[model samples]
Target: MARKYQRANRMNWLMPVLFALPLLCLAGAALLLWGDQLRDLINIAVKLAVIS
Candidate 1:
């Protein structure tokens, strides 16, 4: 019973992280296209903040 509860908790935590992974990849791709500059950093930060 305790193990099941722990697994449920872990799954709950994992789902959001898994979903966020794709968005992170997309953000990284956008950053690559933009080049590594202050603008790109700000854009990535904003994108991550909004998605989260």
Candidate 2:
């Protein structure tokens, strides 16, 4: 019982980080994949803003 309690205590701190890791990875992957397109979009927006 004591071991189980200790294990749960460890997991309580770890669980949220473990759950969030995949989401962080997915966002990183998306940024890598779409980086060029995003850069182009930002440049266009900047140009338009400057013109207007």
Candidate 3:
């Protein structure tokens, strides 16, 4: 019973981290692939801010 409880607790912690790791990787890949576009967006935003 204690072992099961401990395993359940471990799974509760592990599950979210396991799921989030892939999400983090996807975000990193997106940044690497689209960084130039993101940079352009930032520049446009800066220009708009300056104009305002």
Full-model lDDT for every candidate: 0.85, 0.93, 0.92
Best by TM-score: 2
Q: Residue 20 in candidate 3 has what lDDT?
A: 94
lDDT of 2 by residue, 7-51 (tens): 888888888899999999999999999989999999999998896
Off by over 4 Å in 2: 1-8
Tell me the deviation in Å of residue 42 in model 3.
Answer: 1.7
- Estimate, for each residue in 1-52, the C-alpha lDDT of model 1 and write its tens digit: 9999998987887888898999999988987877668687898889988965
Query: After TM-score superposition, what is the CA distance of residue 35 in candidate 2 from its true location, in Å?
Result: 1.2
For all predicted structures, in order, the TM-scores are: 0.42, 0.67, 0.55
- Residue 10, candidate 1: Cα error in Å is 2.3
lDDT of 3: 0.92
Question: What residue pairs clash in candidate 1, if any at all?
Answer: none
| Models, CA RMSD each | 11.1, 2.5, 3.4
| Clashes (N, CA, C under 3 Å) per candidate | 0, 0, 0
On lDDT, the stronger of 1 and 3 is 3
